[model samples]
Target: MTDTSRRSLLGALGALTVSAAVPPAAATASPARATPSTPAASPSPATAATSGPRSSMTFTGTPYDTAAFARSSLGELTATVLPGTPVRTEIRHGGQRVAVLTKGARTVLLPGPERTFTENKQSFTDVFDRLVPDPALPPAKRLKPGWGTSPSGGTWSVYGGTSGDTDFGVHTKGAATMLLKDTEAGRYATLTDDGISDADVNCVAAFDKVPTGNACSFALLFGYRGGGAHYRARLSFTTKGEVDLRVEKVMNGETTLLAEAGPLATEVRAGDAWRIRVRRKGAKTQVTAWPAAGAEPTRPTAEIEDSEAGLRSGRVGVRGFASPGCTNLPVTLITGRFEVTAANWETPPSVTHRDWVRLLDAPFDGEWTPAVEAIVRGWAGSMAPDVFSYAMMFLPGAPGVRGADPRVAGADVLGEAGYGKPDSQGLRPVGADFHDYLERPWTFPDQTRRPEDGQRGNLDCSGYVRMVYGFHLGVGMMAVKDPAKKALPRKSGAMVDFAPGVRVAQRTGSGGSAPDLGQLQPGDLVLFDVNDVAGDPEDPDAYDVDHVGIYLGLDRAGKRRFLSSRKSADGPTMADVSGASTLDGPGIYADSLHTVHRV
Candidate 1:
């Protein structure tokens, strides 16, 4: 999964709309800007994107037939990556040219416009036959005479046809349909097919009649190794419209239940389609089912871990069971369609990166201006992400703002680091008062009464912003020489009034004032009043504000997510470890949002 050519730079929160006191060890590198430019050769249209919210779609196995599954799933052919070393092919479905395949090399050359593929500067001219050979599928056969047309090019093996009255056929209703009927007791029907070990199987099925007394069962069977030895994930319908799910291991003629999900809340009718999926990877298998028309549940219904070597790999199929009392009803189960795919299927970046590009195109009232866009571009072109990630690095037993255990007398770790108590200029924490006793690289300026780290700096919220803008980007203010204007005071509250940056948004309230997101953009400084501190009449702008973070763009759920260094996570994180990086709704700092600045 490692790509050596990835050169995406870290975009810090836009530009320094304000200034802070430069760190003593700040780098003297010249500030860089993201000027407009174009690549030498335009990349082909992207085939897929990765920005979609998490999906429930699971695969049956990998190294399976891509062409057959692609046709079966009816999903657009975005891109395909053949896993290998020295030679791996990444084929983008559209466009004339495909990317090169070689050891430690990826290049695309103009191979003369004849729908050619390039590899190591060599032209694979019009060799579609060599490029995409029809893959060899596993051996299979249809046992019954009227089993109907299998859309998978006849790759299916029939089983459990001892009773002559059992029937099977394909109808025109779905992508691939199986029609089943049973006429006698203990009579069942099954359609199986061979595939790789790790796989994903999905289908929609329903019964023609409700169970009155005897239970009617349908199952998606996997790990089959010949006559009757396999794992089956079954759904049994009973007398009261209730459905129970079970995972069972069958050996010879004996059946053993592995896992069971008691009756579910969803009720099934005569023609209701219940979409079922079976995903088996290594020793773990998961089964999920829901109404085909409804949203898929986030969690699996039944799961099992079978490490038995005897049932590790096998074919997958569908099975139906019936009793003599249900003969007239024929115990009908209609499976409308089936789709199978490899376990490791994913899209390329250029496709998904377009999602953020599209988001930038969205119109926000006072946001999304040309100047703001340039600043955002500059931030992305900078080393912001890398520096931020460095600050987030884990350092076990690292000293932080909270000096040490007070139980141990004179346990003043910060005092040992040469930091002193705060002075009269601003609301600054003494060395010992600023820490949460967490393991993080927390460094602040010497004037802020913090440590001078020879290693990675230990940073608080405002200290982190200062490090990024002042130390890393080299646009920060110098040390204070006058009392008239403080050099970016070393506190979140002080930044609001003293930091020389554009105030993006501010609201004065008791608390619970969320910023108007439409007026905000990526790279903006997001400030918060975590404690709802009592306001100060003398210093209106700097009062109440106590925390700060950098704004990232919208997440998959379209929520405005930001990045911050904090005590709860013991480092920096955009994830919901303690609370999400969002401004409103159930997050920890959601109600504490106070003001915003562009720095």
Candidate 2:
């Protein structure tokens, strides 16, 4: 609904009939005095005159009731009828002493300072009636009862008795006013209209006398269905000005109350009004209420969900009752308006997915990072010392470091193949399989066997790199398990060659031909082609990329440093390197450098 129309409806909801209450203190302040007939543009101070007697008048507390006098040509003024006077009442304002009265004739005089007077003849009731409308007859509407069915399995007529007295009935005074009397001491009388079913129903009722006593209730019914077996919701108000919301199920003439809320505090009186609205969207139902002349409340008075699910839409109307010991008084409920409309429901939009490169490009705002280098640095700072061990394959496992299970030996740790344990030193193993370096003649040798095929707690250089980058950093470059297969593809040089973000550069003896040292970022792998098993020099034809280390960027002295799992003595330690000759004494780098790969 448009906000303006909704506000108007809400205003109508809270509008109450004005009462005969004392005016607030602010209203007793003196009214504005009139300006003199002088040529000066500014207004003059009010002239002091004899103080008038206190008024015995009472005012009706409706707002802006004197609007007619405010808009009249005579301008705003108040008339006070004087007691013990000779047929005269004072007319005030305009800096004049004016009065209108009758002595065998009617007269109006605007007396001047020299006993001179100006006279006019006008009716008094025409002017004063605007402030207080005739109170003998109040404003109200007359309604003819509509026809509908009752829960007693019989035909029903509203405001009229059906064939059997067991059917619902209503009695009206004159042609249009219905007096809902609960003649049956303890029975509830309900009359529903034959309105079409709708998803949303709003019913506003004006009560002439708010009901009281135990079991006394006046309610609005919505979502009603079936003849005698149906389900519906109710918003009931008690004479104590408490409101209750309830949902019920009726089957074979029996009623079951499902859900209820309140006895909520509200302002209600014998001659006041209230409104109730019910709305259903899918399985959720909401009910709301407000004083007849107030704005719509921000939240629902009661909300409920029905999963039993039967009647989704139904008729709407009014029902009331009083208990046995309660006074059987006549209750007249007048409906100002009843509206039914389709529910308004809007769906939210879905989120779009982003790629890995886009994720890496996202801002590095301290809390989040996408690159493996950042992940490694964060892990290194948080992990306890000696957590990483050289020549050991640490598969995902339970908390503490323990030996691998032999039952799943040689099985890929991709799925149900199982994981390995950390070494007894509480260090995370860095190898997939163990290689005898004594016989291999190489510091960092390529892994020749899968993690499952090697001795427990052993891994080669490549396996260490794979575990740290793939398992620790969760990079997708690692071998992913095929959903239909029992094992994932083996990790080999071929997989690394085609891994995501992996860029390889052919090497030259000069070392300058490799990735520029100045441009290298952390996590870059420095690959080396070391001497073969025979202890001979490197051969281009059989140049196996045997050794690698993760670049950890420049140290305090601006020299480059990298971390790697070396021999047992060094374990996983950081090494400093400057140029080819200045490279510190380490297992494999002591031989020679070849290609470098950024991963």
Q: Which TM-score value belongs to model 1? A: 0.33
Number of backbone clashes in candidate 2: 16
Worst 10 residues of 1 by lDDT: 116-125
Stretches of candidate 2 off by over 4 Å are 1-178, 183-198, 307-310, 343-599
lDDT of 1 by residue, 407-456 (tens): 22222111001112212111123222222221233333323332333212
Quantify all predictions' global Cα lDDT against the true fold: 0.43, 0.35
Provide the lDDT at 401 for model 1: 20
- Indicate the residue-level lDDT of 39 in model 1: 15
RMSD of each: 25.7, 42.4
Q: In angstroms, how far off is 344's CA in candidate 2?
A: 11
Instruction: At residue 415, give the lDDT of candidate 2.
Output: 12
User: How many clashing residue pairs are found in candidate 1?
Assistant: 22
RMSD of 1: 25.7
